[model samples]
Each structure stands twice: as C-alpha cells, then as structure tokens.
Target: MTHSSDLLPPPGDESAGALRVQNLDLNLLKTFNAVYAEKHVGRAALRLGITQPSVSHALGRLRLLFHDALFVRTGGGVEPTPRAQRLAASIDRSLAILQAVLDEGAQFSPATSRRTFRLYMSDFAESAFLPTLLRELDGRAPGVVIETLHIEENQFNVAIESGRIDFAMGNFPHAFSHFHHCELLQERYVLMMPRRVAERYALDDHFVLDSTVPPALQFIAVSSHPQSTALLEQHGLASRVRVAVPNFMVVPAILYRCDYALILPRTVARAFAPLGEMAAFEIANASTWPVNAYWHRRFDADPGHRWLRALLIELFRIGTREPHESWLAIPPNLRPSALNP
Candidate 1:
C-alpha cells in the first residue's frame, strides 16, 4: 500500500546515498585496489606501504559504505565478492588513467627511470652511434631502454608529427618549421673495400680510378639514400655498380668476401674499419652533409625529450672529445674538409 519512493532514504539524511558519495575518500579506493590485487589484507598493506591495521580500518569503512562484505576470509587468502569484483574492474582502469596524468607532469630522472625511447634511424646512423651510446648508457642510465625503427624518408615527417617517433637521427636536407633539430656532426663520404682488394690490386689508401680497376671494381650501392647513388652517377662511377643492398651494415660483410666497394659516411666507415678486414678512403668529389636529431615542436618543453637531446649532443657534438678523438687520428687528407680548419 506504501509508495516505492517512501522506501528510499529521506533527503539530507546522513545515511543517504548522496552523503556516502560526498564523503568518499579517494585514498580508500587506492587501498581497495591494493587489497583486490593481493587478496590478503596484510599483503595489501605491504604493497601499499601502510600498516595492516590501516588496511583493515579502510576495509571496514568500505563495507559500511557499500552495505556489503566486499571480501571474505578463506584458507588460502581473501576472495572478492561479486560486487567487489565489479567495483575492482572499474577502479583499476580509473587508477591507471589517474597515474598516467600524474606521470605526465612528473620530473624526469634518467638514473631511475624505466622509460623506453623510440627512435627512427638509418642503418648508417645505427652502425655509427649505437656502440658508444650503449656503453655510455650502461654507465649512466642503466634502466633506460632504446628501441630503433628503420627510417623511412618518405614517412619521416608523418611519423614525427604523429608522435610515433620520439627522435630521428640522420641527414635530412629539408627542415620543417614545426619541428626542432640540432646538428650533431658534419659527415663526408668515403669509399670502403676489403683489405685483400687493396693488396691484390696494389691499391694505395688513396685509390685512383684506372682502366684496370674502374671496370672490374664492383660497387655496392645502398638503396636507402638516393643522393649517394646520384653522387656516384655524377662522378661516372654508377655503370660499374653491380650490387645494390638495402642496409649499410651488410656492406662490410659483403666487402669482406668480394671485391665490392661501398661509398659510406666517414663515421660509419670508421666504425667498420676496426674489424681488421676492411679499409676506408676519402672519395673524390663526395658530398658533405650535416647529421641531425629531429623532434616535433610539441616536445620542445618536455623535460624527458630535452634530456635525450642534450645527451645526444653531448656525445656527438662537433669538436666534442668523445667523437673527435676517434676520427682526429685519421690523416688530414682522409678527414672531411668540413671538419678541417
């Protein structure tokens, strides 16, 4: 005979549902998530870095608010009720989003950070820079992770704009106003060939093209950069090019096995020269280019991006002791003119 509305709690009553929501503490929800994961009050307290009594007190308040026993004791541990399980699913997602929001503004600490940086690089850049960079990282930021993707010149801008690539390392001629860039080094081209090829033809470090070597020398062209091949064609060396490979890393092994010669950046060439099976020589009329690190302007003020940029600049900047020391020992004639006084 009574109306259903009369069964609801009276307005402004302390026990009303609105009062419960208004008095709800976010900290209690955090405790709930911990207990939900651990399934034991004592272990949940340990996970939350709080006392066991504190977890039990919060659970009591949660039970009073929900009007149900959210967890029940079992021989193994505590088990969640049907209502508790449903609450846990929503609570977990909400906490994850909240944590992400907090992290977006947090200060970056490379020494303790487990952050993974995504990079876009050419095989040439990877071969030249990764060895020393990895060693430096091991000594400085042991927890940081670096993942590299092949640089696709055609899709480079799109990737950067969409935030798919955190940084791009290579020589990109065109600069975008919407992006930021810092020149790491000036690089020039060099021709690399096997030690046996130089010994077999009695070729000097300064190779001279002649009727005997020009026709017989097999040129190994990398397909990533068209400019390198164009430079060879410009100098009338393209006709002898018989093999075209996609990666610069493979050029060294191929040169070691055959009489193939590769035109590569000086830094990349020097990195492979230490293998004891190949040699590097300055190529005549080779083009010089600036290697740079590119990032979108949206990350200009991001502390993490700034840290990464500064790290790269410190390691490879022009005139820096680390990179200069390695290439300075090369004869002045063999060094790039851009690097020369």
Candidate 2:
C-alpha cells in the first residue's frame, strides 16, 4: 500500500510557479472555491472561465484526494456536503493569506497602472459620490478605470468577497458589517423645499421638524429613500406624503413643480441648493446615516486597492471610524437563482 504523500512532488520546484501549492496545483483550490461560492458546477466553470467538463474532472480529482463526496447534486444545482462545509473556511482563509503575501510585494503606480476597479453602488450613491470621486481621480490616477455595478444590495458582500467587485459604496450598514469598512461621511436627514414653497409655508433655513407641526407642510418621498418616509410615519405624519417617485433622477423636476417638502440626505440636497432650485434644512432629531466605503478584508494588503481607498478617504471622508481588521463574519447571501451565466 502506498501513502498519499508519497506521490507528492518534491518541494521548491521553481518551474512549478505560483500555481503549485505544497504538491498539488492552486487551480484545484480555485475550482473548489468557485464551486462552493456558486453552488453549481456549471456556474463555477463560467466563473473560472473554464469548460464544465474541466470542472467535473477537477471535482473528481478533489474527491479522490479528500476521500469525500464533497458536494452532492440537488434539484436545482448542488449543495455542499458537511465535509465540504468544514473544509471551506480553512481553504478560503489560506488562499486569502497567500494572496495578501503576493500583494505585499506588488508595486502599483496609479499614474501608469491600467487596472480597472469594479464597484457595487446604489443610484443615489452614484450621484452623491461619483462626481467628486471622478474629479479627484482625474488628476491623481488618470489611468485608473472605474466600473460601477448597480446590483442588488444582498449580492454586494459576496461579490466583493470573491474579488468580483473591488468596493461597495453606500448607506448600507446592514450589508457591509462583515467586511472592512470606513465611514466616508455622515449626513443627517433634511427637509428640502423650493424657495417659493419654503416661503409660502413660512419655512426658512432655520426650520426644524418639531411638535408644533404645520398642517400644510406635506412631503415628497423618493421610493429609494424609505428612511425619510419612515421618519414621517414615526412622527404620525403618514398621510402627509403627497408624492412618491422611483429615484432621484426626477427629483429636481418634481421639486420645482410641487409644494411638497422633500426629505433626503443633506449632501445630496446641497447640490441643488447651489443651483438655487431648493434649500435644505436639518430635521431636528432625525436619523443620520453614514455613507461608507467597504472592501473585503483580504484586500487589506493590496497596494492598488489601498491606494484607491486612500484616495476616496482623502477626498470625502469626514468621520474618524477606521477600517476594522476583523474577519469574524462571512458574506451572508445565497447565490441568487437568476445569477446564471
């Protein structure tokens, strides 16, 4: 009888390159990670940019090496066996550590590098964060490319963790608590209205929402901003909603046409203030939301990612909440059923 370690290749073969780990190839681990993340062999092959048959062959090799089924077929795709689940966190952590070590030696010159940094963000975040961000990048890192994906909120953590997305910028505390994050800025909810509407309601820049409520101060709620609506409801003003729209793209037009007071983030509201279209005033005791930029903990050592995040911090960060160094939480999302390639 021969032992499994006997078949292992001799250590320190330069020809083996970075792909060889211990004795086996790194591609096997990558295949396993992809399949584990995707929950389907076919999707994993697409994610790894390989054929399905190749993934099946790799799975066969993995089964023999581990002496476990690892995964079993399901009606829709595949589910990990108890053994695979046990091996997953260890494999993922090992891979992340190795990648971090490799990144520490890599040099990234923003002026000359052509790496495209992918991001996941909401439409509101796109409008509020991108203009200043683009201007900052224009001079310092002109060669850097940016691609933003307005994906589902639940998908962002998994995407960033897998290195599919570099960062996620938004007011999403619930989704990013498991990752490394920085508070880029904080903004309080504000009551915004056109000059005419403000004047008509005897509202000024010093206006605050208090117990002596004005009956005529109705509200316009953006569908994307439920926080504002919820605030109104909390104040027993649910019936005060006069209009609701899908997003902020049509906000200015609506603000100009209606007398409804719009409640929103002050940073976004200030953009319209300078245009003289509307003015923003702080809502007394209203909830404040932090705009955050989040990335996976594994990228903490990546030079390019670090540079980009630093730039964002310098350009917009106002709060002192530093990035946390904990990997205590995993991405809490299932692969969306429609995420088939």
Inter-residue clash pairs, candidate 2: none
Measured on C-alpha atoms, candidate 1 has an lDDT of 0.75
lDDT of 2 by residue, 1-341 (tens): 54333333446534434433466778888999999999999999999999999998888767666656787878988888898999999999989998977765796788877889998876666766676677767888898889998777677667887899899888776675669888876666777777777677777567677665678788777888888888777777779888888777777777777767777776666544434456556566796678888889999988899899898777667683422111101122321111111
Q: After superposition, how far is residue 295 of candidate 1 from its true place, in Å?
A: 0.5
- TM-score on alpha carbons, each prediction: 0.63, 0.60
Question: What is the Å distance of residue 328 in model 2 from its true position?
Answer: 34
Off by over 4 Å in 1: 1-106, 206-215, 319-341
Error of 1 at 164 (Å): 1.2
Give the TM-score (vs. native) of candidate 1: 0.63
Residue-wise C-alpha lDDT for candidate 1, range 236-325, written one tens digit per residue: 788878899877877767776778887777777777665446666666667677888899999887878888888888777773222453
Question: What lDDT score belongs to each candidate, Candidate 1 first?
Answer: 0.75, 0.73
- Index of the highest-lDDT prediction: 1
